[model samples]
Target: MIIRHFSSLFIAVLVISVGCEKTDRDRFNPLDPLNTTTGGRPQGLQAVAGHERVLLSWADLAIDAVTSYRLRRQDNGGNETIVDLAERPLSATFIDSTVVNGQTYTYRLSVLIQESEGGVIQESPASVPVEVTPGPNICWIADEGLTQILTMTSDIRAVDRQITSIFGAKHLAVDPRNGAAWTTTQFGGADGAVAVRFSSKGVIDRTVTGFTFPASVVVDPRDGAIWIADIGATVGEESSVSRFNQNGGLLFKITGFSEPSGLAVNPNTGACWVADRGNNTLHLIGDDGTILLNINGPGQPTAVSVDPTTGDAWGINVATQQVFKIRSDGTISLSVSGFIQPVRLACSALDGSCWVVDAGGGQVIRLRASTPDGYHIGQQSDFHLSLTDFFVPVDVSIDQISGQVWIVDRGDGSVVKIAANGSIIRRFVGLALPVALTVDAGPR
Candidate 1:
């Protein structure tokens, strides 16, 4: 009888131990008001303000214990509201389109978890509030010497945000449709010829490799496709132009070029104009990888730009110090000389005018199109800046909304904003080798 009593006691102890073990079915009590929170708060909460909208995103929760999220938004006037998210599997990003532009908003996020079989809930602590202001215009600047990308305010008086750690960031292009930016890294890192895409919130969205030496990149304003010019490993060896989707997927790659240094996409038709410096040729390639027109004899055309107002493409031959306007039908309508080392040209959509940056001349010259190919150079009313204003001006872009020319002076390490009437609006100084600048004035 004593032995039977001992066995009963041992069985009772085993049952108690098994009951004490935690099981997967055990729910966390998130509603406990004793300040002991179970689930952790959302991390890396970032808010990007846009035109009448704000995008909020956070890192994924480390565990699968979260059942829902509670996002709280507060405006500048102390008005608070909880965003209604009804999806079961919550997304990491939320776009609040009900926001108004120019108004500041603050946001906080928390996690909610089921704590019991009866649907009792527990809430994680709210994240720190993030504040942002929406604006219509922003400028993206790429500094190769500093290896950084900077976003400047609409007025060009202050920097809105800066993203560092980019290696050999030579050039950048912004997509006005989504506010994302794409750039090519020319040096350093294991992946030397790499291209990176940054999201609207300044986060690395995607990185595409396998380029030999990407010289320039541009976005198709019509369809948001990305075009890259890989100058190849060596001159006249494996040079190519590739097209990528907005998500960084390779759509198509057009090969057989000799150092395609400059790429310009036709804003209306999504076609690409490839300037091959090594072969001294200008190629007009269709979006479907077909060579529509190949014109030889532009004297090493290194840079090209298209005017959306007219389908004509303008190219600059650095070796010849000349600019050529190529008509849409594969014919050179006009070839103008007398430029002192014209490195880049940007055609304005506002008036079909082209702004040329002459590094040797140290001037930004504006040329208005009279015909399809001709810019009236001998005309007395041409807009020309004095050479004293710029030193080694490498790139030029136009603000379509305001028709102001933005010039990147690499030697002076500054970006100059000039009004259409030949007045300096703002001179953004103290940059480290600013190589490229693109203006984003919302959607056209």
Candidate 2:
């Protein structure tokens, strides 16, 4: 009986030892780098601001041991969300395109690992949190009749601030980096023609004078230099484009062009594209006032713009009643004929698509360089009526972030906002001859 009892006790001891061994094998080591109680967390996490997106990056743990990752985000309203990677990413970067402007968000990242032997999942402690706040992509409109520059949200909501007494303000440009604006006025200031700069709050910052007829103004997105296409007293004679610092000081002036009626700055390169209507040429002038390339033959190019995404230039030839696109290297890419009068054109910064305002057709047309055979016409609100006396759109601008288009309806004395598909979004009426406008891509 004693022998049997001893054997049973030995067996019980053996069973307990085996169970303890299994528990130790499956248990996580606190000293292990992959341990959830210790290291193995993602480090150096970063968040960058984008138009309507947030870019996140981090230094992940070793790929051999890591199974996936976890991203946690907290919005301003105290709402939290967690995102888990289905599979490990080749790179440690993710783009959150679902964000909106004017909202603040905080983010955290953690490493995920699974034990090979036990098939037990473990999550490392989260990394340090990072915070970022996004935008206020506003639109600045130039009213020739009211002699004012108005600011509004991309959704066509008024910004509650307007720069007054800007007489003959036919064209305007806003610096996205600082929210400052520059415009050309033909009749208000001490000089008959001047390039005026205003602070973000409707206060006149600086007024650069000595221009015969400053037909167009633009701000280089690469550098905050203001450029003015001064079409001198006579067309084609003494016409020049001048560059100025943010403080209204002259940087340099390039002369010897006829009727420099329009100016567009290349966002990548601070260079400017001048449309000389008198000479019927498009001149790509370097930032330092050097003539880079001159492409002849867009018959009387009245207005010009550059697509930030493609670096291509789009111009409207009112004289030829056509719209054309020019490659950055000075070659004519596509020229589409058949318009009563295409007055102004604006290019999408996010895409190479161009929007043209055909005054005679009373239509806003969208052109894509990839598909040269066809164009999309933004449907006006009165499309069903087929009214001949509809609103006459004289100028066009685009919100780079949202891809929405804003048109200046000089005929109806109103401004209209439309989607990229040409459906009317909203309209703001009762303005005095809204001739020109620009959507501010800068952050407020």
Candidate 3:
């Protein structure tokens, strides 16, 4: 009887022990790495902006006895950046503070199943990349440049310059920040050479050289790189684009231009619109020098302009005395005719106005455009902007800000600054056989 009683006691002990083991298995720690697949994975990760902060949130995230969750971001190069939070399979959010204007950032959503002692729980494969770009108020100058010159490209000038260089200098571009003026010597340039930087006082601050027959020059606002088109092939050689830092340090030289004459760089698109006069065409080059499209025309096209707002290209043909409206698909159309060697041009983003310089007849013309290349003064898009006749208007430029016009008259050796309606606002006489004219909006 005593032996039977001892066996019964042992059986009871075994039963209790087995029950305890089952309980432990059923309640596994949710945070344990093996427990990560407890209820599947996180879903619907979205990025939301909250007053300078980015909030990364997810839905239906499963958690049990976990310590924390880990979040990460993925860059365009496929690198991972992180954000972390504590505890629970519950849905969660992460607030990101490292965001600013003019910057593009990408992120990936992930869940971290926290480990017991140290180190983080294993993260799920990065969620599809989510992006949020913060916006800031930008002080952008309305590029009402040569359009005003085109409207009045021909009129009342001795040296009839193109609108962009309507004054006495080959106004290359305007410093986007402070609107300082830049230009080059037109007649004989060896390379990516910058002849002068006109201060607010109209004084030369710097001169840059060391390029190959530079034609059009532009400064990048993002990295502030100076890009100049080298027309070396014009004299029987290959052509290229010379890139330099803002301070004049040479960066790189890009080849494959055929008599490239004019260029306009869109800061927004990072695309360069180059006028390849060799084939009477316009080549839209990427920021990295890739040609997006090659738009051809009926004549030798020289001047190029880009509408940053609409992403359109305007090719004004000097040889054919016509303007070609170029679509992004490499399509071209004759927007207007009867241009007398329209050498330079500009467009106003403000009122959709346009200007052109006719060096052939010493005239400055204007066309009020509703769209980038779609403009008409009455039925004729080509209207003589000048009330008086020009002897030789070589180049042209216009001031959209002040509604003033600046022109270089080669015949009179003078630079004329006029009001919007062809009235002489101010005249600079005896400034050489003035070759070009551009408005310096910075100078009051």
TM-score each candidate. Answer: 0.68, 0.65, 0.54
Candidate 2 lDDT tens digits, 299-414: 88888989887788988877767777888998887777666777888888656777777788887667664646323233332211111233689887887777777788899887
Output the number of the TM-score-best candidate: 1
Ranking by TM-score, best first?
A: 1, 2, 3
Put down candidate 1 lDDT per residue, 65-153, tens digits, no spaces. 56777899998899998974648577889989988766777899888777565687777788778887665777788988887898876
Q: Which stretches of candidate 1 lie over 4 Å from their true place?
A: 1-135, 235-237, 371-388
lDDT of 2: 0.76
Worst 10 residues of 2 by lDDT: 379-388
lDDT of each: 0.79, 0.76, 0.57
Candidate 1 vs candidate 2: the TM-score winner is 1
C-alpha lDDT (0 to 100) for residue 383 of candidate 1: 39
Clashes of each: 2, 3, 68
Cα RMSDs, all models: 14.8, 17.7, 24.2
Candidate 2 off by > 4 Å: 1-135, 235-237, 373-390
